[model samples]
Target: MISKISSQRTRCKSWLLGGLFCAVACVAQSQAAGVTWSSQYQDRLFDSGGGVLDTQFSFEVGIFLPGFTPTASNVDLWESNWRTLDRAYDPTPEDPNDGDPEGWNVPEQFFVGYYQIEAGGYSSSPDADPLYAFPGGAQAYLWVYDSKSLDAPREWALLTDGITADNLADAWVVPDADAGSLEWYLEDLDVVIYGGGNDLQGPGGYTLDPVVFSLQTHSVAVPVPEPGSALLVGLTLGLAALLRRRGLSAARG
Candidate 1:
């Protein structure tokens, strides 16, 4: 009789312990999926660049989608806005004090910025679009630049044909590595919905946007839980130890 009672208690303990772990796992997954890609974001009143109404941002690495970049560079690598260095832009030696413009021969200017979209990062749009409407069957475009090239190639390489909208569009980036360290950036995103054109530019075709997506002053800033993850880890461990102790007591009795 004692043995049977002990076995039953052990089973009960096992069930409870399993449930605790399961609860934690489920909570973590949901948090991950529902969590906004940007650690913080803000809504723009007037769409200036790429007609973006909302811009997303995050300091953490996973803010972007998977496969976007197996490895990503920090924010310092963002190369956002710059015109080509040409005759019109060339500096004249009119001022003898002016330094040498020879160094300006590089292909493009570099700025490191995270991914962003016009609409808010959600299945349902909470932010209003003042400039353009978000159309159906919008296509995704990936732009990757070579930071180490001698000319710093003006061209951006394509990463994919088309990507589905899972509410986390514009959540990827391409890293520019230099001397085994990441230098500049190219964003691998899927938020720009190009509907006017056919092909991938159509509802679900693959094509690159000829235009650039610019950031505004009103972008959303969604802060992530800095302490919650660690707390959850502690709770999980505590519960596990408690359950184990109870099981041992039951077995001995």
Candidate 2:
């Protein structure tokens, strides 16, 4: 009778341990099934004396994959426009809508992640059609201000080489005479941008263009465990604890 009871206790413990492992594994597998691509931009304005201006803007975009469908609740987007600057420009006597002062040109920057997601459904532009780039769609694209030309007709160039889902974290050199560099990576669950080398000098100082900077990254999305899975884990733990206590009590008896 004593040997039989011991074997029963061992079987119970083994079953509970196996249940706990399976529950945890289910949660891990759910999270590893998909990838997410994210991007963000921060634009800072400065006065001619290098004083930081009151107006700054930032925007963010997130895209989850498996299928590039927005209806899948895979795309998240938001932007903060220049409200103060827009208000300041609104009250101007001439070109009231044009608040941007000369030489403080808002550098044009674009990330392909935004374009791809928007082109998937969020954008109304005819070019937004995914099929528009049929036959050979781009893996990624970037538009950066021309560092060589700070004059009129500010040129923005499109870069493609070395830019892809797998290579987003790499510092990509801007194809220009100056060969400026930029990087995109994930931080705190968001993509952050860091780069410089544009010739245009704003009030903030030279060598760095604070007018606009962007970062992008692609990473696997971490999924939350289902309520049922969580409950199972909790119950398993409770049962294991109870079994442990009962076994101890039986041994003492």
Candidate 3:
């Protein structure tokens, strides 16, 4: 009877140790497989006269990836706008209702998307080299209408293959990295606004332009242990403690 009891205790300890090891492995796997890509937009607005305005707008979005890492060659081609809540608008001195002044709300409804273009295809100007020269030949862009032009939406739609504000609601979907032509990934992102100057007239005859536009991208890893794994670890430890108490009671008996 003594030998049999000893063998049972050894088996129980071995099983408890195995359960602990499995719990640790689960946490390590989650850390290695989960990654999220994030993009941020920042801009400083100025009046047509080049005086810095009190208004500012900034936005950020995050895309989750399971078992994936962003690389220049693995980026996908896609376009979509983030949710309205992701858009940040500061109060402008000229317009109290919305930070943006009348006839100058272009940034309020811009789209964020990725496109693949030949090297130097999308230059700052007709004579300038490409604004972004990524190794994998892909670029990210923010598509917005001209704030001062009455026909800006139509012109923007025509340039972007019929994408307009009317149809933007349907295009607001989470991007699938594996669905499109894999040309590049979010290893790094840089966006520079060109051509348009801070000369557009805003409400009350106040002209405004984006004097500073900056885009930044980065990746974050989120590792959370699975609930099941945590429960299993807890149960194993509890059972080991119970067994020890029972063993001590048996010896006393």
Best by lDDT: 3
lDDT of 2 by residue, 35-126 (tens): 12223233332222223322232222222122332211221210111010000111222442344432121232211221212212222122
TM values, all candidates: 0.21, 0.23, 0.25
Q: On a 0 to 100 scale, what is the lDDT of residue 192 in model 2? A: 20
What is the clash tally of candidate 1?
22
Worst 10 residues of 1 by lDDT: 81-90
By TM-score, rank the candidates, best first.
3, 2, 1
Task: For each candidate in the order shown, give its overall lDDT on alpha carbons.
Answer: 0.29, 0.30, 0.31
The TM-score, computed over Cα atoms with residue i paired to residue i, of candidate 1 is: 0.21
Best by TM-score: 3
Clashes of each: 22, 3, 3
lDDT of 3: 0.31
Badly placed stretches (over 4 Å) of model 3 are 29-190, 193-208, 212-253
Which parts of model 2 are misplaced by more than 4 Å? 10-23, 26-56, 63-253
TM-score, prediction 2:
0.23
Model 1 per-residue lDDT tens digits across residues 113-199 = 222222222122122223323232232232222221223212122223233344234323221111111211122233322121111
Evaluated at residue 203, the lDDT of candidate 1 is: 24
Q: Which ranking of candidates, highest lDDT first? A: 3, 2, 1
